[model samples]
Every structure is written in structure tokens, then in C-alpha cells.
Target chain A: MITLKDVNKNYSSEVSIGPVDLEIPRGGITALVGPNGAGKSTLLTMMGRLLGIDQGAIEIAGMDITTTKSKDLAKIVSILKQENHFMTKLTVRQLVGFGRFPHSKGRLTAEDEEIISRYIDFLHLAELESRYLDELSGGQRQRAYVAMVLAQETEYVLLDEPLNNLDISHSVHMMQHLKDAAEQFNRTIIVVLHDINYAARYARYMCAMKNGKVIHMGRTEELMNNQILTDIFETPIEVISTPQGLLACYH
Target chain B: MNSTVALTPKPRTSRAPLYTAKLGLGCLLVLILLALSLLTGAFDIFSGEEGREMFAISRVPRTIALVLAGAAMSMSGLVMQLITQNRFVEPSTTGTTEWAGLGLLTVLFFYPSASILFKMSAAVAFAFIGAMIFFLFLRRISLKSSLIVPIVGIMLGAVVSSVSTFFALQTDMLQSLSVWFAGSFTSIYQGQYEILWIVLGVVIAVFILADRLTLAGLGEEFSTNVGVNYRRMVLIATALIAIATGVVTVVVGSLPFLGLIVPNIVSMFRGDDLRSNLPWVCLGGIAVVTLCDILARIIIAPFEMPVSVILGVLGATVFVGLVVKGGANAR
Candidate 1:
């Protein structure tokens, strides 16, 4: 389990997120959904220890994030942010190999290479493995980065806005891939998703945030209602049940 | 698996043999130039005992200094570029060499008879501080483009150089300062050039940390997420750059653009994996400097020109080409 108690971040006098107390249970996908400036990414980054918390503590799998050595923590949690820009040119395979750095320290053994290739193949990037990252299309590059993070072999994977710039089909494919990884690998995946429909369809649990606070957290069904999402997003959101599933439409 | 034909199979298929051939050719060129540099000086190596004495005292020391300074400066530029995530930056552009000059000038002003060790230490200290200041300044502003970094660095360097020039004029050591800043291997000797050995040690350290440094170049969040201690790596890189710049500045004066151009050229051909690219960068550095030093010797015969002038013209031309290509790509 990953636990956050009184977690707060004061970016400035005007913007702050905090006093959040929550527990994200292990296994299954938890989608953090809300409007812009809702602090979903902030909370995810804090859990990943990419951002510091001012007031309280975060514990991932019973180890405090702030106290744990970064090298050790890396073996437990892996995070992929929205934007990853590299000044150096790197191939898809080489970028995935860096995911093994925490374990092998840049000297990848046979086992590490096998694992890297497995993630590459799993992500359907075998064709692009030798291609440079800059040469890949947006969707392909996003999958490549996700492959890299998954190659870390960490129990907890946090991705912030992994679907940005992806077309609808690619987004659905990526969500399916992530859902399968969560189930097959027995990993807890927390993803910040902008599309509430994807979260409703794929996520087992949902955490809604607004003004830097968790407004609601429960099973996907419980948070799928019109009242809660409307209150959380501060917009008129209508929930309609279709043949497929419950969908939230704010249009 | 689905059949997805490789779009660029030829580049991959031809890379290994091409890399080997390039390495072989570079080594051959360096050897030829080293021979030319050693044999073509004012004193003929074909002569008897007097020639042997001259070779040992002047030619050998000069050659060693060129190799050490060249390789170290180029590697230092690569390290700076990685740490700063900017391709245009080098020790000269970053005010590091100018700070060393200022430090040397301060030593000359206060302690006219100061030992070389004292001068070197002072220069290293100043260079370290100057690099730290540049890093801190970079942290404060969000850069619009990579070109802005070197532009800012050049401005910083100009500011520091003016301060050194001001002090030189006041102390009436303007001629001495100009000679120190001109960067020539003409005065290098066995005893005077031994300080560059410290740079050799620094370069070795850089090699050991090459992978980590490359990771650090990927930005702080990514590097830290991958378990690298980003701040510590930055500190280590800063120290390496300062030491390399300081030693070269004190020993052979400032070889502007030698650092900037060699690594840029190397990365243009061999990608940016530091461990693999480092040797080529060093070899390129040594080869370029050896060629420039030879040109400096032969272009005016025994009169000789400073190697910095040749490097500056070459570096500027290449830098402009890179900038133009980069701008076109961005557009």
C-alpha cells in the first residue's frame, strides 16, 4: 500500500496543494482524474518522490519515501512524467536499457538485456528498437517511454498524463496494455488521466481531485455518479448509462 | 511478430565497419601529425646529441602538453555540455578560462614571485567558483534555446576578461597578461608542463563517471528517478571542468574553442554515449591540436602563430554551421 498522511506542497502563496490523507491499495489501476490545476500530477509526483512534501509523510509499501535511499526507492517505484526531452540521441532499445540502471548500474547482464527485450516486444516496439527516439511518431515514442518505465520492474508505476498527444485508438491500446501489465505483473499502477471515460472503463479505483485536495476516492462505480464528478470538476457533468458502460459527458 | 521492414537498415548494417575504419584512420592521422610535429621543428631530430637535447627539452614536452591540454579541454567541454544540457558551452565560453586568467593575474599582482603551484591552485579555485556562479545563474533563468547559453557565456567571459584587463593595465602587466592569454605551447618545458598530469587524472575520473554523467544530461527528474544522485554528479562535473580548464590555462594559457569544437565534431559523427564517445573526443582533440600546432609552426615558419587563433576561426565556422542547421531543423 502507498499511504499519504497530511501531505502538503506550497508552491507559492497563491497556489498550494495539501493536507491530503489517502491510501492507495496495492494491485490494480487507480486513475487520478480532475480538471487542470487540480493537483493530480502533483500528488502523483510527490508519491514518486519527484516533488517534496512540506507537512507530512508518504510511505510506499511500508517504507517512508523521504527517508528511503533514492537508489533503493527506485527499485520500488518508477515514474514517467508527461514530457521527457533528451538532449542526446538515443535508440529505443538503449533508452529501455537505462531502466535497468538502478539494478545493473549501466552494466547490463544477460538477464537485464532479456528483460529489456521482453518489455520492448511487449510494447510492440521490436521494429522500432533500433530506431532513434526522435525518429519515432508521437504515439510510438509514448509507448517506448512506457516500455522504458516498465522495464524498471518496479512494483509501483506512476505515470502522469501518458496519453497526451495520442489518437483515440492509440490511447485505447495504451490503456489496455497498462491494464494488462497491472494484472499480469501484479503491479499497482497510478495514472493521471485527463479523459474520464478511459478512467471509467479501465480503472478499478478512481481518485478525484480539485483545488489540490482529494474530493472523492472510491470504487469506479461509486465515483462515476454525476453529482460527485460535477462537484469535483465544478462543471455540469451528466452521467449516462449506455450499452458499454457509464460515461461522463460535460459537453 | 508482425513483419515491419527496417526503414534505415543500411546505416545500422554499415556502422560497425565504418566506426572501425574511422577509428583506424583517425589514429593514422594522429600518428602522422605527431611525427610531423616532432620532426619538423626548428631543431632537426636527425642531428646528433645537440638535437637529442633539444628534442628532450622542448619538442617532447611541447608534444606532451599539447596532447594533455587538448584531450582534457575537449573532454571537459563534453562534460560541461552534458551537465548544462547545452551543446554550445565550453570552458572558454563559460568564463572558466577567463576566471583562471583573472586568478593568475591576481597572483602575479600580489605575489610577483609566486610559485607555479600557487598560481595553479588559485586559478582552479577561481574557475570552480566561476563555474558554480554560471550554474547558479542558469538555474535562475529558463533558457529559450541552446544558442542563448553560449551567448550568455560569451558575455560572462567578456565581463571577466575586461576585469582582468583592467587589473593588468593598473599593474602595468598588460604585456604579460596578453602573453598568458594568447595560449601557446612555445614556452612549455618538461618541468613547467607537469601540472597537466593532474588533468590526466581528472579525465580518468570523468571516464569512470561517464555513464552517470550521461544520465545526468537527461534532466534532473529523469536522472533522479533512475537513481542517480544528480546534484553530486553536477558537483563532480564542475570540479572536473574547473580543474581541466585551470591546469590548461596556467600551463599553456587559454586555448579558446579547442574544447568547444572537438567534442561537437566528435558527437556529430559518433552519438553522445559518453563512454563510447569519450575516446573519440579525446582522439579528435589530440589530433586537432597537433594539426593546429603544426600549422602554427609552419604557417609562419620559425616565427610561429598562437594555436588559439586557428582554433577560434575553425570553431566559429563550425559553430555557425551547427547553429544554422539547428535553426533550420527547429523551423
Candidate 2:
């Protein structure tokens, strides 16, 4: 369980993210969907303890995130941000291997290595495991980063816009991977995504934000209605049922 | 169950233990080089019977100065690069060395006969303040352009160097300033070289904070997330770098590019884990300095060229190599 009590983030005179009071349940995929500058990234970062909260507290899995030591928090929750820009050269396996830093402290044990290899193969990155991150295509690099997060083996995975720079097929594959990780491992996956359709189709729950506040949050089906979607996004988004699941079309 | 079992492959450590071995060997090589440097000198101190006064006074201190200055400057460069997330930055490149030079000039002008310790303290403090100013300027510029960072730093260094030059000329202290600027290890002796121990203190502090420093390199938000105090880390790192530069400048004069070259070379062999690669950087530094010192003594045959000139040529060669390699492998 992750609880936010009166959390607020104020960057400048005009910019403030929250004074939000909310609780996230123990296990499920919660899709944070909103427009640009809607505090989606800021709120996600705060939950991950990546950004400090100015006037409130956050607790993850019965532990106060603020007071918890980072080495321990890293074991419970792992986060991957939107962009991964490292000047040094690293192969996919090498990059993913760093996921075990919290556990192994850079000296990887046999078990840690096995887990790293599993995540790599799970992401279909075997062919590119030896390739440097900079040498790979955008989609491949994105997958590599995702694999690294998965290799972290944390119960809670926080990813901010994991689909950015991915192609349509890779995007779908990534969503499926997240869903699988959530279902199989019982991991609590919190993802910030732009595509409402993907959120509607795969997410068990949805949290909608606007100007730093959670305007609407509920089950996927309940939150996919036309009136709620249109009102939240200020656009006419029609909900439709496809063969796979529910989808929201904003065009 | 069978499918999942088949799917999961055994994990293995990507980094080899031999990498550690290589680093250890590198350190051993540096020690050997240092020993050789202690034994050899300008007056053929090794050839005669019992060691003479020149060996005790000139040769030993000069060698110690080279090793300390080289390692400290290179380590400072590594720290600067890690903090700024830019490979091109170094103490010299970022004006820390020039700032120290300016500080030395001020002391010379005001309290010409100040103790070596007093002169070094003044230089270290001024250099730290200058580095902090540059850091603040970086913070104020919201838009981060990597190229502009080094350009701004170099320009700042040039401005400070010019000020020092102008003052030196006015006070007829240009001779002293010019000699210091040339970065010669020749004049270092026992009494003068103890000031460089301050750099060893900085090195110890750096080793203690190595993991946190590595965390800081990942970016500000990430560093904070990982429980590293970013502002504090930057302040500590900047202070260490300035003191390292100041001590080196006082002991052996200014050795340009010693800072930039060693870190890059070490990073090429080892990955960016500062803790692991630090030993490699320090070793590479000692090796380069010892070799350069040997060449500096041997090349002119009884008349020694400054070690900085040797380092300048060597550093330029390595830097050009890196640039060419970077261009060839442009992604």
C-alpha cells in the first residue's frame, strides 16, 4: 500500500503539483493518465521518492518513504524515468546488471546474474544483449531500460512514460510485458502513459490528474465512460469495446 | 511451469574479477615506477656510494611532488567530470587551477614572504570560492548545453589567468608567476613539498564518499532519489577539487591536462563506476607522471625540461586520440 497525505510540490510561484491526499492499493497496474504539465511526472516521481514532498508524507508498504533508507527503499520499489542518457558505453546485459546494485552492490552474485539474464530474455533482448546502448535503436534501448527495471526484482515498479520513443508494436509489447509482470509476479506497477487506449485496455485501475490534482480514479471500465473521459481531458473521447478489451479513442 | 522454467536463463556477473586484478596490477606498476623515480636523479645519485645531500633534498622531494600532484590532479578531474556529467571538464579546464594561480599571485603581492602553508591555504580557499561561483552560474542556466559548459569554464579560466598575468607584470613578480605557470617539478624539496599532503587528505575523503559520488553522477533527481544529498555532494566535491588543484600548484606548479587525461584513459579500460575506477585513475596518473619525470630528466641530458611540458604533449596526444575515436564511433 502507498499512501499520500497532503503531499505538495511547489517549484516556483506559478508552479505547484499537489496538496493531494490519496492512497494506492497494494497490488495492481495503476495508469496515471493526463496531459502535459498535468503533474503526472511530478506525482509519480514523488511516489517513487525521487522528488521530495514539500508539505506532506508518503508511505509505501507500511514504511515511511521519506525516512526509509534508500538502500532499503531500492529493494522495495524501483523506478525508471523517461530518458536514460549516459555518456559511457554499456551493453544491454551490463546495463541490466546494474539493476542488482541495491542487492549486490556492484559485485553480482550468481543468483543476481541469473535474474538479470531472465529479465533480458523475457524482454526478447537476447540478440542485442552484447550491443552497446548507444548503438541500439530507440525502441531497443527503451526495452533495455525496461529490462533493467524488471531485473531490479522489486515488488513495486514505477515507470514514467515507458513507451516514449517506442514504435506501435514495441509499445504494445511493453504494455503486455507490464501486465504479465503484474499478473505473474504480483508486482504493483505504476506507469505514467499518454495513450489512454493502452491504459484502458491493460490497466486494472486508472488515476486521472489535471493541474496537480487527482480528478478521477477508479476501475478501468468505470473510468472509461464518455462523459468522464471527455470532461477530464476536455475533449470528446469515445469509449469502444474491441475484441481484446475496452479502448478509448480520442480522435 | 515448464515453459517459465525454460524461459528463465541463469544469470551471470557481467563484470569480471579479472578487472579488479588488472587494477591491482596497475597499482603495483605505479609503485615500482615511484621507487625507480626515488632512486634516479640529475646528479647520478644512484651511481656513487652513500647517498649525497642532493639526493636527500632534491631528488626524493621532487619525485614525491610529481606522484602526489599527478594523482591528485587526475582524481580531481574525475570528480569534476562525475559531478558535472561532462567528460571535458577538469581543474585546469574549469578555472580551478587558474583561480589558485590568481590566489597565489594575490598572496605574493600582499604578503610576499608568507609561509608555504599560508600561501597554500590562501590558494585553496580562493580556488574553492571560484569553483563555487562557476557552479552557481551553471545552476542559473536552466537550459543545459554540454558544449557551453566547458566553453564557459575555459573562458573563466582565461579571464582569471589574464588577471594573474596583469598583476604579476605590474609587481615585477612575473618571473615567479611564469616559473610557477610552467609547472616544473625540478625545484621541489623536502621543506616545500609537505604542503601537498593536503591533497592526500582530499583523496582519503573522496574514497570515503566514492559510492555517493557515483550516485550523484546519474543526475540530480536520481541522486536525490537514491538518498544522496546532491547539493552537499557538489559542495564537497568542488572543495576537494579546488584543494587538490591548490596543493598541486603550490608543490609542483601547474601541470595542465594531467587532470583530464588520466580519468579518460582509466574510464576507457574500466566502466564508469567511480569507486572501482578510482584506483585505475590514480595508478594511471602515477605511471604517467613517473614516466614523464624520467623523460624530463633523461631527454635534456643533465638539463631537465619541465614535467608539465611533457604532460602537455602527452595529454594533447591522448586527448586528440580520444576525439578522433569519438568521431569515428559517433552515434
Candidate 3:
């Protein structure tokens, strides 16, 4: 379990997040969904220890994030931001290989190499393994980045909008991959998502935020409602039930 | 199962032999350039006892200096570029060599009889400060363009060099100062050039920290996420660059573009895998410098030009090319 206790971040007097206290249960896909400037990304990054928490502490599986060694935290949790721009030209396999760095300290043994290849193949990037990142298209490159994070093999994976720029099909495929990764690996996956429908479909639990404060946190079933959606987003949003699943329709 | 990740017939590391062969070829080319540099001097070492002594004292030391300085400077450039995350950054461009020159001048002004080792330490110390100031200062400024980084560095170098020139002029040691930092192998002889070997330690250290350094190029958050001590690696890289720049400045003067051009050219072909590119960067450095030294010898036969002139022209061309072509990606 990951716990945030009275966590606060003051961007300025006018802009701030928390004193938030929350508990994230272990071993399921939890999606943090909110509009822009709602601090969903901020909260996730703070929990990942990518951002500093001003007033409180965050713990992952009983280990304090701020106090634990970064190297040790890397073995337990891996985080990926959306807008990754690499200066170094890396092939898919090589980029995935770097995921083993925390464990192997850059000396990739045969085991590390096997794991790297596994992640590459798992992401269906085998044909593009030898191709440079610059050579890959947007969707393919994003998948490659996801493959790299998966190769980290951390029990807790924090991803901020892994589907930001991807088209519809690629986004669906990415969500499916994350779901499979969560179930098969028995990992705790936390993601920040803008698409409410994607969150409603894939996320077992949904945490909704508004104006830097979490509005609600519970099972997706409980949170999917027209009134609650409108309240959290502060817009006219209707929850529609279709043959497939629940989707938030806002027009 | 977990072991089933490798689904295809192609094994991992399939490119190992090909990588080795390409590296071997690059080394072979550098060796050939070394031979050419060794044979290109004005004096005839093919004659007698006096000629053989001259060969041992001057020609051998000069070529050795070229090899060591070249490899060390280029690798230093690679390290600095990765640390700064700027393609154009190198010792000369970043004011490191200018700071080293200032240190050299300061040592001579205060203690005219200071040993070469003492001079090297002062140069290294000052270089460390200069590189740190540039790096830390660059971090605070949100640069409008990455090209502005090297411009800022060059301006810093110019400012530091003006101070050096002023001090040298005041002491009437300007002529010696110019001659010493002239970036030449002309003054190299057996007893005077051994300090260049200090850079070999730098090369080895870079080899040991190659992965961490490369991760640094991916940016602070990325490397930090992967468990690297990013700030610590930056300090280590700066120290390495300073040591290499300091020692090379003391021994062979300032090879202005050697660091910039060699690594850029190597990266053009080999890409940015520092661990894999270590040998190629080293060899590419040796080849470029040795080839330039050979050209310097023959260009004005019976007299020599400092190798920096050739390097400056070549480096400026590549620098311009990178700035122009790298427009979209410079940010």
C-alpha cells in the first residue's frame, strides 16, 4: 500500500495542492483523472518522489519515499512521464536495456539481457528493436517508452498519460497492455489520465481531482455517475451506459 | 513463461562481431595516421646517430603527445556534451581551456620556477571552477536557444582570455604566454611532454562511468528515475573534463576544436552509446589530431604550423553545420 499523509505543495499562495491524506491499496490499476491544472500529475509525481512534498510524507509498501535510497526505490517503483525527449539516439532494445540499469548498475548480465528482450517482444517491438527512436513513428515510439518502463519490473508503476499523443487504436492497445501488465505481473499500476472514458473502462479504482484537491476516490462503479462527473469536472457531463461499458459523454 | 521473452531466432548481441570489426578498423586508421605523423617531420631521421637521437627526443615525443592529447581531449568533449546535454559544448568552447591558460599564467607570475606538475594542478583547479560555473549558471537560465549555450561559453572564454592577456601584457610575459598556449607540437621534446599521459587516467575513468554519463545526457529526471546519482555524476564528469583539459593545455597547448569535432563526427556514425563508442571516440581523436599535425608539418615544409589552425577551421565548419541542421532538435 502507498499512503500520502497530509501532503502539501505550495506552487504559490494562489496555487497549491493538499494537505492531502489518502491510501492507495496494493495490486490493481488505479487511475488519477482530472482536468488540466487539477494536480493529478502533481500528486502522482509527488508520490513517485519526482516532486517534493512540502508538509507530509509518502510511503510505498511501508518504505518512506523521501527517506529511502533512490536506487532502492527504483527497484520497487518505476515512473514514466509523458513528454519524453531523448537526446541520445537509442534503439528499442537498447532503451529497454537501460531499464535494467537500476538492478545491474549498467553491467547487463545474461539475465538482464533476457529481460530486456522479453519486454521488447512483450510490447511487440521485435521488428523495430534495432531501429533508432527517431526513426519510429509517434505511436511506436510511445510503445517503446512503455516497453522500457515495463522492463524495470518494479511492483509499482507510475505513468502520467502514457496515451497522451497516441491515436484511438494505439491508446486502446496501450491501456490493454497496462491492464495485462498489472494482472500478469500482479503490480500496482497508477496512471494520470485525461480521458475519463478510458479511466472508467480500464481502471479498477478511480481517483478524481478538481482545483488541486481530490474530489473522490473509490471503485470505478461507485464513481461513474452523471452528478459526480459533472461535480468533479465542473461541466455538463453525462454518464451513458452502452453495450460495451460506462463512458462519460460531455458535449 | 518469463524465459519466453526472446521469441525470435536472432540472438541478442548479434552485432558484437560487427561492432568489434568496425572498432578495429577505426583503430587501424588511427594507427596509420600515427605512422604518417611520425614520418612527416622536417628533419631527416633516416641518416645517422645524431639523427636517431633527434628522432627519439623530438619526433617520438611529438607523435606520442598528439595521440594522448587527441584521444583525451575528444573523450573529454564527449563527456562534457553528455553532462551539459548540449551538443556543442567542449573544453575550448566552454571556457575550460581559457581558465587553464589563466591558471598557467597565474602560476608563472607568482612562482616563475614552479614545476610542470604544479602548473598542471593549478590549471586543473581553475578549469574545474570554470566548468562548474558554466554548468550551474546554464542551469539557472532558461535558454531561448541551445545554440546560445556555446555562444555564452565562447563569450566567457573570451572574457577570461582577456584577463589572461592583460596580466601577461603587464608582466611583459605576453610573448611566452602566446608561444606556450599556441596549440602546437613544435615545442614538444622527450622531457617536456610526459604529462599528457595524465589524461589516460581520465579516459579510463570515463570508461568506468560511461553508462552513468550517458544516462545523464537523457536528462536529470530520466537518469534519477533509473537510480543514478545525477548530480554526483555531473560532478565526476566535470572533474574528468577539467583534468583532461588542464593536462592537455599544459603539455600540448590548446587544441581548440579537437574535442568538439572528433566526438561529433564519431557520434554521426557510432551514435551515443558511450560504452560502445569509447574506443571509436579515442581513435577518432587520435586520427583527427595526428592527421592535422601531419598536414601542419607538410603545409609549410621546413617550418610548422600549430595544429589548432587546422582544427579551428574544421571545427568551425562542423559547428556551423550542426547548428544549422540541428535547428528543430536544439531545444
Candidate 4:
């Protein structure tokens, strides 16, 4: 379980986000959904220990994230941010191999290599494994990054905007892979997403934010109503039942 | 569906053939450069008895000095680039070189006959302080704009340089100051090169903290999230860089672009994995410096042009090549 208590983040004099208090239970997909500037990404990053909380503490899997040593914490949680721009020319396999750095310190054991291969296969990145990261298309690169986080083999995974720049087919594929990872590997996955329908479909639990605070939090089914959707987004949203599940239409 | 079906498990990268071959090639290049540097001088050192004495006193010390300066400056550059996450940064860019030159000028002006040891000590102190200031400036700015970092650093260096030049002119020491700031390996004797040991110590520190530097490059939040002490690591890296830059400047009088050229070339050949790239960068630095030193000796024949001039030309040429190649690669 991940817990945050009264977390406040002040970027500067004018912009501030949250004294937010929230709990994310273990063993499911929890999607953080909100419009731009809603602080959903900020809250997720803070929980992942990627960002510091000015006035609060975060605990991941009962370990205090603020005080835990970096190598020790790396074993428990892994996070992927929105951007992964590197000046290095790295093959996909070489890049994913870095995921084992905390464990092997760049010396990959056969077992480490095996785990890397498995995650690569899981993300359908096997064929492009030897290609350089800069050589791949946007969606392929996104999948490679996700694969790397999974290769980290941490109990909890945090991803900010995992679907950014991906096409619809790739988006669906990526979400399905995340769902599979959650169910099969029993890892707690917290993802910040812009697509509300994707959140409704794959997420077991959902947290909706407006400004900086969590405006609504509940099971996915409970949060998938037209009234809550419209209020959360501040736009006219209609929910229609589909064969797959409930889909929210704003346009 | 077709793409998913086409997926195949990736083969593991071995440390034997592929890695070892690259390592061997790097070592070979270094060894060849060392021989070339030892042989290429004014007195035909490879041919006769005068060769051995000249080899021991002049050629040997010169070669060792080049290797040490190259490795130290390149590693310093690599660390700067990593910490700042900007490609254009070097020991010179971060104001360490300028500060060291300033320190030297101040010592010369204040105590005209100060011992070399005292001068070097002052240079190290001033350079370290200047590096700290650079770090503080970086800390104050958001890491979101790393592109602005090199610009800020260059402007800071320019300010320090102008101040030093102003002081030099007032004291009529401008020529002496210009010679030291211009960067030449011509005056590096055995006693003079002793300060470079401090730079070697810094190289060891870089290796020890290599992991932290790599993590830090991922950004402060990510590094902190993974449990690194970001502020402490940055401070340590900055101090080491200052020492490296200061000692190199005091010994060789500053070698323009050795740091910038070596690391970028190494990164182009090898990936940016610092652990692997470091040794390669060190070797690459040694090669560039020794080769440039040789050219400086031979290019002007008996007159001997400064090594800094060679480095300036070489660095500028390589810088242009990298920009053009990077653009072409992007296309």
C-alpha cells in the first residue's frame, strides 16, 4: 500500500498544489484522471517519491519513502516520467538492461537478462529489442519504456502519461498490457491518464482531481456515472453502455 | 496482431566477444598514441643516445602530462555534462578554468615571488568556490531548462574572464595572464606536473560516485525517489570538477576544448553509460591530447606552436562535425 499524509507542493510563489491526503491499496490498477493543470501528475509523482512533499510524508509498502535509502527504495518502487530524452544512443535492449542497475550495478546476471527478455516479450517489443530507442516510432518507444519499468520488477509501478503520443491501437494495447501486468504479476500500478474512457475500462479504482485536491475517489463502477463525469471534467459528458463497458462521450 | 506475432525474445548481450572487442580496440588506440607521443619531438628521440635522456626528461613527462590532463579534463567535462544534463558544458564553461586563471593572476599580483605550491593552492581554492557558485545557480533554476545552463555558465565565465583581464591590464601582467589562459603543454616539466596527481585522485572519486551521477542525470525528483541524496551528490561532483580543472590549469596552463571534445567523441562511439564510457572517455582524452601535443610540436617545426592552439582548432573542428552529424542523424 502507498499512503500520503497532508502533502503540499509549492513550485513557486504563485503556483501550489495540495496538502493532499490519500491512500492507494495494493494489488490493483488505480488510475489518476483529470484535465490539464489539475495536478493529477503532481500528486502521482509525489506518491512515487519522484517529487518531494513540503509538509507531508509518503510510505510505500510500509517503507517511509522520504527516509529510505535510494538503492533500497529502488527495489520497492519504480517510476517512469512523461519524458525520457537522453543524449545517448542506446539500443532498446541496452536501455532496458539499465533497469537492473539497482540490482546488479550494470553487471547483468543471466537471471537478470532472462527477466529483461521476459518483459520485452510481454510488451511485444521483442523484434525491436536490438534497435536503438531513437530509431523507434513514438508508440514503440512508449512500449519500450513501460517494458523497462516492468523489468525493474518492483512491487509498485508509477507511470505519468504512459499513453502520450501513442495511436489508438497502441493506446489500447498498452492499457491491456498494464491490466495484464496488474492481474498476472500482482503489482500495484498507478497511472496518470488523460483518457477518461481508458480509466473506466481498465482501472479497478479511480481518483479524480480538480485543482490539487482529490474531488472524488471510488471503485471504477461507482465513479462511472454521467453526473460525476460532468462535474469532474466541467464539461457535458454522456455515458453510454457499450458491449465492452461504460464509455464516456464528451464530444 | 501481426506486430505482436512478430515479437521475439531478445538475445542477451555478452561481456565476452562484443564488449571485450570494443575494450581491446580502445586500449590499442591508447597504447599507439602513447608510443607516438613518446617518439614525436624535436631532437629525433627515437634514434640515438640523446633520445633516451630526452625520452626520460622531456618526452616521458610530456606524454604522462598529456594523458593525465586529457583524462582529468574529459572526466571533468563528462561529469559537468551529466550533472547539468547539458552537452555544451566543460570545466571552462562552469568558470573553474577562468577562476583558476584569476587566482593565478591574483597571486602573481599580490606576491610576485610566491612559490608554485602556493599559487596552485590558491587556484584550487578559487576554482572550487567558483564551481560552487555555478552549482548554486543551477540549483536555483528549474532543471526543466537545461538548454539555458551552458549559456548561463558561459556568461558567468565571461564575467570572471573580464574581471581577470581588467586586473591584469592594471598591473601590466596582461601578457603573462594571457599565456596561462591560452592553454599550452610546452612548459610541463616533472616538478610542474606533480599537481596533476590531485586530478588523478578526483578521477578515482568520479568512479566511486559513478552510480550516483548516472542516477542524478535522470533528474532530481527521480534520483530522490530512488533514494539518492541529490544535493550532496551535486556538491561532491562540483568540488571534484573544480579540483580537476584547477590542477590541470596550474600544470598545463589550460587546454582549450580537450574536455569538451574527448567526452562527446567517446559518447558517440560508446553509449552514455558512464561506467563503460568513463574508461573510453579517459582513453579518448589521452589520445586527443597526445596527438594534439605531437601536432603542436611538429606543425610549426623548431618554433613549436602552443598545444592550446592545436586543441582549439581540433575542438572547434570536432564541435562542428558533431553538430552537423547530430543534425544529419536526426534527419
- Tens-place lDDT digits, model 3, residues A1-251: 88988889998988899978888888879999887899998898888788888888999999999899999999988899887876677677778888888999888888898888777877888778888898898999998988888899998999999989889999998898899889988889999998989999999999988888888889998899999999888899999898889988998
TM-score of chain B of each: 0.93, 0.91, 0.94, 0.89
TM-score of 1: 0.96
Interface RMSD, Å, model 4: 3.2
* Model 3, C-alpha of B156: deviation from truth (Å): 1.6
The per-residue C-alpha lDDT of model 1 at residue B226 equals: 86
Among residues 3 or more apart in sequence or in different chains, the pairs in candidate 2 whose N, CA or C atoms overlap within 3 Å are A113-B11, A113-B12, A114-B10, A114-B11
Q: Across residues A1-251, which tens digit of lDDT does each residue of candidate 4 receive?
A: 88888888997886688877888899889999887888998887777777778888888998998888777988889988988776555678766776776787656799988888888889877778778788899998988888888888899999999999988999999999999999999999999999989999999999998878887888988888899989988999999999999999999
Model 1 ranges with Cα > 4 A deviation? B1-22
Q: How accurate is candidate 2 locally (lDDT)?
A: 0.82
DockQ of 2: 0.34
* Candidate 4 CAPRI classification by DockQ: acceptable
For residues B278-306, write the lDDT of model 1, one tens digit per residue. 87888899998888898888898878898
- DockQ of every predicted complex: 0.48, 0.34, 0.43, 0.42
Write model 3 residue lDDT over B1-331, tens digit each, in one string: 1324445676784122335777778778888888877777778888799889998999899999988898899999999888877789999998999999999999999999999999999999999999999997798877667788899999999999999999999999999789878899999999899988889899999989988998888887788788887889999999999999999998888999888888888788867778888888888888888888888889998999988998898888988888888985544
lDDT of 2 by residue, A1-251 (tens): 78889999998898897788887786779999987888999999988888789988999998898899877888888888997686755678777887777777666778888898788878888767767787898988998988887888888889999999888888998899899988887899999999998898889989999889888878989988999889888998899888977878877
The candidate scoring highest on DockQ is: 1
lDDT score of residue B170 within candidate 3? 99
Clash number for model 2? Answer: 4
Worst 10 residues of 3 chain B by lDDT: B13-22
Writing each residue's lDDT as its tens digit, candidate 2 over B1-331 gives 0123333254345653445666767778888888888776657675565556778887778777777777788899999988887777888778888899899889988998898888898889889988998888778775355656777888999999999999999999999998888888788887878778778888888877876776677676656544456778898999899899888887788888887888997777666766666777877887888898888888987798988899889887876776677667654
lDDT of candidate 2 at residue B272, scale 0 to 100:
72
The CA lDDT at A191 in model 1 is 99
Error of 3 at A105 (Å): 1.2
Q: Which has the higher lDDT value, candidate number 1 or candidate number 2?
A: 1
